[model samples]
Target: MAISYDNTGRGIKVLVNGVHMKTIPVLLLEAFKNHHGKIAFDKKRRITPEERKLLHSYLVYLKWIRKLRKTEKHLYQLIKDTYPVATRKVITLDSERFELVLDNNLKIKCPEKIYLLFTEKPVIIHSNY
Candidate 1:
């Protein structure tokens, strides 16, 4: 499966065998599944030290934002300004969710359509240039 984020940041374009499959919302999603499955993504690109440092900082920033939302309203406002987060996007699967390999040694839960597209055959995931 090839996943590409829309250039306008509207949604995620999912492709199967070079054909359009579905477009999902742009979300920070986490996938959970109990069943073992095949993964086609490359796992050889280890995160560099600098990238690890940046990732750590990003996690800390998210933690701070969560804390600020509860404890410091003014500070949160100053931080987020007018950028209100959109409503959460949820995916419900009848069977166990599938494991989706992502960059930076990450894995996410995706619906069956997306999962089958990726696991049924090898695919080259592309980025929007």
Candidate 2:
């Protein structure tokens, strides 16, 4: 998957497997809240470090999903319904770790090791094992 800025430089174009997907705004400020837990854009609409990290993680996850959709059809079908809901929920990636805060107030921790496998290196298992 590849992400590029739109010609206007105000939105992002997400491409999967060389196919163009929909373009969304570069910054989804409404999907996030401020440090004080406020969801208003009173201050400047700047992308914080936490937001940047969360966005990067989301992109990596999307790429992984695209790969899984092709190689693991069953698994992809099982989780497809949850993907949209999960993406719409609030996410926070701070010094401690990555966390997904759901609408029902349920908190889920994102595994860094799994993300590393998709973004950095793949884990290889020998047939002998």
Candidate 3:
């Protein structure tokens, strides 16, 4: 994995590794998706020519934004208050596809580039209220 950061660049790192396109592991993908942020891809993975091009496009996009995880305080309330009315837990939506698991489902859809924007952050979350 290679991380590139310049003296004047924002406090972000870009990791470039081979791309591998496969169905993300369910549990890990679930937890990763739960966040309101973007992650970047930096590890080596075997991928087809088409997938490699797409993945490369996503990586280039990452160098421009300050991607952050979704803050529950910022997005959850909106989901809770607006969801039951518009969409429900059964609804699964991705930027490219929408799977309605229930009525009035209108879940937010984000692109995969978000995941590739952050590949080094810890996968665990700690909370206290």
Candidate 1 residue-wise lDDT, 1-129, digit = tens: 434333337644444456554443343211101100121223323333443333343344455557778988865665542221111122344323354454333444434444443353443333332
Model 2 bad stretches (over 4 Å): 1-7, 10-42, 83-129
TM-score of each: 0.31, 0.39, 0.19
Tens-digit lDDT track for model 2 on 1-129?
Answer: 343333348755434355544443555422321212322223334445554555555555566667879988976675543422231122234334433333455434445643342233232322321
Q: How many backbone clashes does candidate 3 have?
A: 14
- Could you tell me the lDDT of residue 88 within candidate 3? 16
Q: Which is better, 1 or 2, measured by lDDT?
A: 2
Give me the overall lDDT of model 1: 0.39
Query: Which candidate would rank higher by TM-score, 1 or 2?
Result: 2
lDDT of 3 by residue, 1-129 (tens): 433322223222222343232323222333233321334343523333444444444344333222322433444443342211121122224313212111246445334443333233323222231
TM-score of 2: 0.39
- Model 1, residue 43: displacement in angstroms? 11
